[model samples]
Target: MKVGFIQFSPILGKPTQTLERLEYLIDKGKHSDILVLPELCNSGYAFNSRQQALNSSESVADSKFIRFLHEKSNKYNLYIVSGFCEKSDKDLYNSSFLVGPNEYIEVYRKSHLFLNEKDFFSPGNTDYSVYDIGICKIGMLICFDWVFPEAWRILALKGADIICHPSNIVLPDLCQKTIPGHSICNRMFIVTANRIGTEDNLTFTGSSIICDPRGNILTQASDDQEEVMISDIDLNLARDKSITSRNHIFLDRRPDKYLDIAKAIEESV
Candidate 1:
C-alpha cells in the first residue's frame, strides 16, 4: 500500500483559505492509497480561548470540513485519516476521523490533552477505535496520545496494522524519536502527520515520519517544510508479531502482573 503524510502549517481561524491551499497542495502531490493530515488541519490548533475553540469547531453530524475530506477521498480514490476540531453536542473534542470510499466514518477523539489544551477541550470519553478498510486495519490517535505506550498497545492488541497519528507538535524531536520504539514494540506501521509553522507563541515541529513494523524509517519530512512524504508499505509485515523462533510481541504479554496500570492515581497511592 502507498501511505503518507501531508505536512503543512494550518492557518488558525481561517478554514476557507486553509482548505483551499490544502486542496491545491493535494492536487499537486503524488498519489497514495492512505494519507494522513496534521492535527486540527481544518480548524487549526493553538486556540486562544475556550469560546474561540468552540466557535472554530464543526459538528461531526454536519460539517463542511468533513464533506471536503469525503469529496477529496472519493476524488483521489484514497483513504484519509485527518484531525478535526469536533463539536459534539455542547462539548468540544480534539478529535480525528477516517474517511474514504465505501467506508463508514469512524472518529477517535484525543484521549490525552497537552499543556493548555485542557482549558479549551474536554478529555475524550471514547475508547480507541481501529477501522477496517478491506486492505488493512487502521487506527487513529491524536497529538498528545503518542506519549502513552498503552494507547499504542491497545490498538496493536485490537489488530491494527497501521496507526495514523495526526499531530500539531511543539516538542522538538521527542515524539519522532520515541515512535520508532513504539513501532518495534507493537509491530505496527505508524504514519505521523505533523504541521509546521508557528501559531501565537508556539512554533510547531514538523518532522513528519512514516515507519515500518520493524522500526525502519521509510520516509521522513523536514522540520520546517510544507511537504508530502510517502512510502510503499507491505501490509503483511505488520500482521506478524513474532520477534524470533520463541518470542512474540503479543502472545508473550504478562497482563496479570500489570494490573496496577489501570488503577486510579489515588487508589495506586
Candidate 2:
C-alpha cells in the first residue's frame, strides 16, 4: 500500500492556518492509503510560557479539529496519524493519534518529553501501541521517542511491520546519524515526518523521510522545505524481511539479560 508523509510548514501558534494547509493535504491525499504529519504540526510549538502552552492545548475527546481528522480519514478511506498537544483534566500530553476509516483507533502519549515539555507536559504512563491497518501491522512514536531504542523495540517485538514516527528533528547531523541506524537495526519500515520553517527561534529543517526495512532511504525531502512523499510499501515484504539473513540482527537479542528493564528503570526513578 502507498503511504504519504507531509513535512508541513510551521504556522507559529496558529492552529487555524495549519488546519487550512492540512485540509489541502487531505484533499490531495485521496489516493494514498495512509497520511502522516509532523510533530506539533497543528499548533506550532509555543514554549515561551507555561500559561501560553496551556492556553494552546486542546482536548482530544471534544476537539472539532479531531472531528475533522476523522471526517478526512473516512472521506479518503485512509488511515491518519498526526502529532498535537492533548489536554485532559489531569494534565497535558504531547500526543499522537491513529484514526482509521471507521473510528479513532489508538492514541499514544509521548513518553520522552523534550526539555521544556517536561515543565508543561506529563509523560505517558503506557507503552507504545501496535495496530492492524489493512494488511499492515503498524506502530507509533512521536518526535524524541525515536532517540530511545526501547520505544521502537517494544513495537517491533510486538509484531509491527512498520513503525511510523512523527517528529520535528531540526539538527541535520543528529538526524543524519540517528535515523538510518534505527531503521537498519529495527528491521521494520520507518516512516518519519518532520517539519520546516522558523518557529520561536528554532529553525526546523524538514528532511522528512521513509526508510525500508534494510535502512535504505526510499524517499527524503530537502532540508528546510515543505513537501509530501508517497511510496508503495508491501507490509508483507517487511514482515518477511524481518526474518531473513540480512535482517536477522534485529532478533539476535539478549532479552534474558534485559527482563523488566522498563519497569526497573521506573522503580529506580
Candidate 3:
C-alpha cells in the first residue's frame, strides 16, 4: 500500500483557507492508498480561550469539512485520516477521523491532551482500536498520544498493520526521535503527519515521516516546508512480527511480569 502525508502551515482561525489548502494537498496525493494530514487541519491550533475553541469545533455529522472529505474520498478512491476539533454532546475534543470512499471509518480522540488542551478539550473516552481497511488493519493516534508507549503497544497487540499519526507538533525533535522507536518495538508500520510553521508563540516541527516495520525511515519531510511525502509499503511486512527465526516480537513478550505497570502509571497520574 502507498501511504502519504501532507505537511503544511495552517493559518490560525481560518477554516475555509485551511480546507482549501487541504483539498489541494489531497488532489496531489491521488496515487496514494492512504493520505493523512496534520492534527487540527481544519481548525488551526493555539486557541486563546474556550469560546474560541468552541467556535471552531463542529460535529462530524454536520461539519462541511467532513462532507468535503467524504466527497474527496469517493472521487479519489483513497482512505483519508485528518485531525479536527470535534463537538459532541456539548463537549469539545481534539479528534481525528478516518474516512473511506463511502463512509466514515473511525473517530479517534486525542487521549493524552497536551499543555493547555485540557482547559478546552475533554480527554478521549475511546480506547485504542484497529480497523480492517481491506488492504490492512489500520490504527489511529493523535499528537500527544505518541508519548505513551502503551498506546502504540496496545495497537500493535490488536494486530494493527499501519498506525496513522496526525500531529500538530511544536516541540523540536521529539517526534522524529520517538516514532521510529515505536515502529521498531512493535514491528509495525507508522505514518506521522505533522505540521510546519509557527502559530502564536508555538513553532511546529514538520518532520512528517513514514517508517517500515523494521524501523527504517521510508520517507520524511523537511522541518519547515509544505510537502507531500509518499512511500509504498508492504503490508505483509507488518503482519509478520518475527524479528528472527528464534524470536517473534509479540509472542516473546513478558506481560506476566509487568502486569502491575498499568496500575503503577495510573497511581502516578
Candidate 4:
C-alpha cells in the first residue's frame, strides 16, 4: 500500500487559506492509497483563548472544511486522515477523522492534550479504534498521544496495519526519534504527519516521517519545509509479527506479569 503524510503550516484563524493550501498540495502530489495530514489543519492551534477556538470551530456536520474534504475524497478516490478542531454541543475538542471515498468514516478525539490545549478543549473519551478498509486496517492517534506506549500497543493488538498520527508538535526531535521505537516494538507501519511554522510563542517541528515495521525510515521531510512524504509499504510486513520464527512479537508477551501496570495507573488517576 502507498502510505504517506502531508506537511505544511496552517494559517491561524484563516481556515479558508489553510484549506486552499491543503487542496493545492493534494492536487500536486502523486496518487496514493491513504494519506495523513497535520493536526488542526482547519482551525489551526495556539489559540489565545477558549472562546477564540470555539469561534474558529463548528460542528463536524456543518463545517465547510469537512464538506470540502468530502468533495476531495471523491475527487481523488482515496482515503484521508486529517486533524480538525471540532465543536460538539457546548464543548470543544481537538479531534481527527477519517474520510473515505464519498463518505466520512469515523472520528478520534485527541485523548491526550498538550500544554495550552487543556485550557481550551475537553479531554477525549473515545477508545482506541481500528478500521478495516479492505486494502488494510488503519488506526488514528493525535499529537500528544505519541508519548504513551500503551496507546500504540493497544492499536497494534487490535490488528491495525498502519497508525496515522496527526500532530502539531513543538518539542523538537522527541517524537520524531521515539516513533521508530514504537514501530519496531509493535511491528506496524506508522505515518507521522507534523506541521511547521510558529503560532504565537510555539514553533511547530515538521520532520514528518513514515516508518516501516522493521524500524526503517521509509521517508522523512525536512524540519521546516512544505513537502509530501510518501512510501510504498507492504501490508504483509506489518501482518507478520515473527521476529526469528521461534519468537513472535505478540506470542512472546508476559501479560500475566503486567497486571501491576494497570493497577499503577489506577492508583495515580
Candidate 5:
C-alpha cells in the first residue's frame, strides 16, 4: 500500500481553500492508495470558545464539502482521510473521517483534546477502532492521543498492522525524538500527517512523517513547507516483521508487576 501525506498551511476559517489544496494534491499524487491530511485541516484550529466552534461546525450529512471529499475518493480510487469540525447532535467534535471510494468507512474523533480544545470540542469516547483495508488492518487516531501507550496497545492487541495519526504537532524535537519511538515501542507502522502555517497566532511547522515498525523514518515533510510525503508499504512485510521478531519491546512487558502497581495506585487514590 502506497500512502501519501499531504502537509500544507490551512487558510484560517476557510474550508473552500483547504478543499482546493486537497484537490490539487489528489490530482498530483494520482498513484497514492491513501491520502492523509492533518487534524482540523478544514477549521484551522481557530477556537475562541465553544460558541465559535459551534458556529463554524458543519453537518456530515448535509455538508457539500464532505460529500465532495467522498466524491474525490471515488474519482481518484483512493482512501481519503481528512479532518473537519463535526457538529453532531448539538455537540462539536474535532473529527477525522476515513472515507472509502464508496462511503465513509470510519470516523475517529480526537480523544485527548489539546489546550483550549476541551472548552470547544468534546473528547472522543472510544479507545481505538480498526478497519480492514485490502490485506492490512488499519487503525486511526488523532494528535495528543499518540502520547498514551494504552491507545496504541488497544489497536495492536486488536491486530492492527498500521496506525494512521492525523495531527497538528509542531516542534522538531517532539516529532524527531518522541513520536518516532512510538512506532518502535508498539511494533506497528506509524503514519502521521500534520498541519502547517500560522492560524490565530499559532504557527505550525509541519513535519508530517511515516515510520516503519522498526521505527525507521521512511519519509518526512520539511518544516514550513507545503509538501506530500509518500512511502510504499507491503502488507506482507508487516506480517513478516511481527512474526519473525523475537525481541519485541511490547511483548516483554511484565503485566503481573504492572497489575500490582495499578492496584497500589487505586488503593492510594
Candidate 6:
C-alpha cells in the first residue's frame, strides 16, 4: 500500500485558509492509498486562551474540514487521517479522525495533553484502539501520546499493522528518535505527520516520516519545510512479530513481571 504524510504550517485562527492549503496537499497526494496530515491542521495549534480554542473548534459531524475530507476520500478512493480541534457538546478535544472512501471510520482523542493543552482540551476517554481499513489494521494516536510507551504497546497487542501518528511536535529529537523505537519494538509500521513553522512563538519540528517494521526510515521530510513524503509498504511484513529465528518481540513480553511499572512511576511522581 502507498502511505504518505503532508507537513505544513497552519495559520492560527484561520481555518479556511488552512483547509485550502491542506486541500492542495491532499490533491497532490491523491495517488496514495493512505494519507496523513499534521495535528490541528485546520484551526492551528498554540491557542492564546481557552475561549480562543473553543472559538476555533468544530464538531466532527459538521466540520467543513471533515466534510471536505469525506468528499476527497470518495473522489480519490483513498483513506485519510487528520488532526483537528474537536467540539463534542460543550467540551473540546485534541482529536484526529480516520476517514475512508465510505466516510468516517473512527476518531481518536489525544490521550496525553501537553503543556497548556490541559487548559483547553479534555483528555481522551477512549483507550488505545485499532480499526480495519481492508488493506491493514490501523491505529491512531495524536501528539504527546508518543511519550507513553504503553500506548504503542497496547496498539501493537491489539493487532495494529500501522500506527498513524498526527503530531504538532516542538521537540524534534524526541519524535525523530522515539517513533523509530516504537516501530522496531512493536514490529509495526509507523507513519508520523508533523507540522512546520511557528505559532505564537512555539515552533514545530517538521521531520515527518514513514518507518518500516524493521526500524528503517522509508521516507523522511526536512525539519523546516512543507513537503509530502510517500512510500509503498507491504502490510504483511508487520504481521510477523518475530525479530529473528530465536527472538519474538511480542511472545517474549513478560507483562506479568512488569505489572508494577506503572504503579512505581505513579508513586515517584
Task: Report lDDT (CA) for all predictions.
Answer: 0.91, 0.78, 0.91, 0.91, 0.77, 0.90
> Per-residue lDDT of 165-267 in model 5, one digit per residue for the tens?
8888754447546667777766778788888887676777688888887778889888789887789986654554343457545466677776654465568
Worst 10 residues of 2 by lDDT: 241-250
> What range of 10 consecutive residues in model 3 has the weakest lDDT sum?
259-268
- Span of ten consecutive residues with least summed lDDT in model 5: 236-245
Off by over 4 Å in 6: 264-266
Reference-based TM-score, model 3: 0.97
Q: How high is the lDDT of residue 136 in model 5?
A: 71
For all predictions, the C-alpha RMSD in Å is 1.3, 2.7, 1.3, 1.4, 2.5, 1.1
TM-score for each of the candidates: 0.97, 0.91, 0.97, 0.97, 0.90, 0.97
Instruction: Summing lDDT over every window of 10 consecutive residues in candidate 1, give the lowest-scoring window.
Output: 21-30
Which regions of candidate 5 deviate over 4 angstroms? 241-254, 260-269
Model 3 lDDT at residue 154: 95
lDDT tens per residue, model 2, 182-265? 777777888888888876777777788888877788888888766878888866656763455664654567779877775756
lDDT of 4 by residue, 31-133 (tens): 8788899999898998999889998897888889888777877888888899999999998999999888867568999999998999999999788999998
lDDT against true structure, model 3: 0.91
Error of 1 at 181 (Å): 0.5
Q: Mind giving the per-residue lDDT tens digits that candidate 3 earns over 1-269?
A: 79999999877778888888877888999899999989988888999998999898889889988888889999989999999899998899999999998775689999999999999999999889898988888899999999999999999999999999999998889888999999999989999999998878999989999999889999999999999989999888898888899899878989899877858666867
